[model samples]
Target: MERVIVAGGGLAGVRTVEALRAQGYPGRLTLVGAEPHRPYDRPPLSKAVLRGELDDTTVDADWTALDCELLLGHRVTGLTDVLETTAGPLGFDGLVIATGASPIRLPGDGPQHVLRTIDDARALRADLRPGARVAVVGAGWIGAEVATAAAKAGCRVTVVEAADTPLAAAVGAEVGAKTAPWYAEAGVELRHGVKVASVERGGLELAGGGSIEADAVVTGIGVRPETSWLEGSDLTLDDGIAVDERLRTGRPGVFAVGDCAAWWSSTFRRRLRVEHWDTALNAPEVAAANLLGGERVYDPVPYFWSEQFGHMVQYAGHHPVADTMIWRGDPAAGGWAACWLTGDRLAAIVTVDRPRDLVQARRIIAAQKRIDRSALADPAIPVRDA
Candidate 1:
């Protein structure tokens, strides 16, 4: 490919450019970023940045060496053989769609906030003053992290989750309930099984005939792929831009990666749209290789980590609901891990403050190793041996 245009100048987009250059592709690379700022680390938006520990979370990259044309504050409106950007029509021999996803906002008129960008974090941080009433809707990763940061900022935080427990959709209700006490310990109210009907000027109206008074509301329901620009494209678009194991979008010279790509993972035996930093960091290498006529498969043991409420939560691999769950160590004691296995093969692992388990679990899953459930349950037993 003589020329390449990468849409969405986020982590994934930048990584794609870096990978292409690293693979010795001395082509005309163009990166279009909607944000005025360059690609930045997004994970810290809810933690360090929101807490005001850092002025900005801009990503550390050797941009001078990459030698790519960057189109900052440029939005891609549509796509065909050429990208229809606000700047104008830009043609490319190859295209990478890494538009990523946007946070889901709560319905109604209210001062609602989300932790998606540096600006968003700054806006939210300003509202999180000491004793400011902050009602966070949803108990997912973003919600939990925001709540933790707000609490640390001395805000009176109340997390409202629609499920019976926090992270029910992620780790299941049983395991999620184990973390309910964490909110209380942090001096944040955790309200479960509550749905927000609407957001008003000073608070959130509950569907269950109640209301929560808050100075500000933050919603972390989830994110939807930013693929509206590809609405009439010949490529398939489901929840995200559908791509094969090679990250190809059916259209020649077009590929999608990161949060916007729902790649069919042969390893997981299913299509997965992992919206995590690790995916954004690692998937580009494979996609870049494929863009250069290399048959590289993008099947990774999906991994993610979160820091909230004085705990480090890490998960590796995709664990289907049918997998058998085994707990290692006493979860009630704080530091422990839950291993998911399909028959004897390790499927996934979720650990809380157990870095060794996450490190070993990733290796076990990558190797597709069979585990001794009894031995794995013992905290003293090493995962490699188990």
Candidate 2:
């Protein structure tokens, strides 16, 4: 049996192991992790875990119950042909890198927090008291969700973002401008188009002359690929481990997946790295297929979801050349769906509070079918049929 060594027991790594077993690959498997907890679901860490809806139930499958040798609370310092760990060196026929990502931390003292792991969420949740001032550094998804949770707990929340509008870079200003009113409705003070220069004893100084009083400041700017450990390992690391269409890392028996992998995407016709929960859940099956001698390529339609205030937002497909935008319903009225098109083909769809539209939008994007703009704009028409 070919021995398989999987690094970073995250969603991708766990799924790869399960996938390998399901494919009937009777190999020696070892899962390594820096975190002490068993490989758990991370999407909940930002949503339900922050809301205190779940605990360790976040894990997909129990390691002990599965009888897999798990190396938790230990960080893999170096990855040669073998791994140098605290226990001892281990060899393998194949390796999978799924270290995931780390939260962008603010430069400051102990008070500045970030919500990436369960511990980070626990610390932030304990401090959510009524009337306490919170300054969220970035207005991305994490900042938005944290602000919503803080506001619901009766805390005075102020979101400080460098961009003119939240998610301006991701969804573009057209859709971003339309989505701005939700923060105001949630009673969150949005301080857009300003940068936080420094952190003082109890507040954050802006690039401009003003400063905001903050009992707690959270830095949710963004996350980068956790590939620093592979610096001297001769692996191609460009933002992430550079992989081919087959998820191979150029080395003989190494693979990369999830947020830490920048693979050539045939759909986008470029190297792409998606940091969404759906990618983490979906990419490992492809990696597993290739590991078991099956020729498989991961050409998935990138998908993601976010919950803020009372809105459930979902996005499907890649919008590389999305130059035109069309709305299926009124944005002001709330429950609406919008599509970004490139040359008549659906590039991406952003659905707000419309679950059925999102499901239909996915089918439309996958089929590569062109729908009449007028027909798509009319909410009365079935999106799939259109």
Provide the TM-score for each candidate, comma-separated: 0.98, 0.96
lDDT of 2 by residue, 1-386 (tens): 46887888788879888887777777678888888877777777667777777766455575554446788887777788788766678888888889998887766553688887878888988887899998998888888889888898899999998999987877877777777888899999998999998777798988888889899888899999999888899799998999999999888778899989999988768898989888888888888888777779988878889898879989898775687888888988768887888877787888899888888878888778886778788888877544
Per-model root-mean-square deviation over C-alphas: 1.1, 1.6
lDDT of 2: 0.83
Model 1: per-residue Cα lDDT over 86-125, one tens digit each: 9999988999999999998888887799878889989998
The global C-alpha lDDT for each of the candidates, from Candidate 1 onward, is: 0.91, 0.83
Worst 10 residues of 1 by lDDT: 318-327
- The per-candidate count of clashes, in order, stands at 0, 0
Off by over 4 Å in 1: none
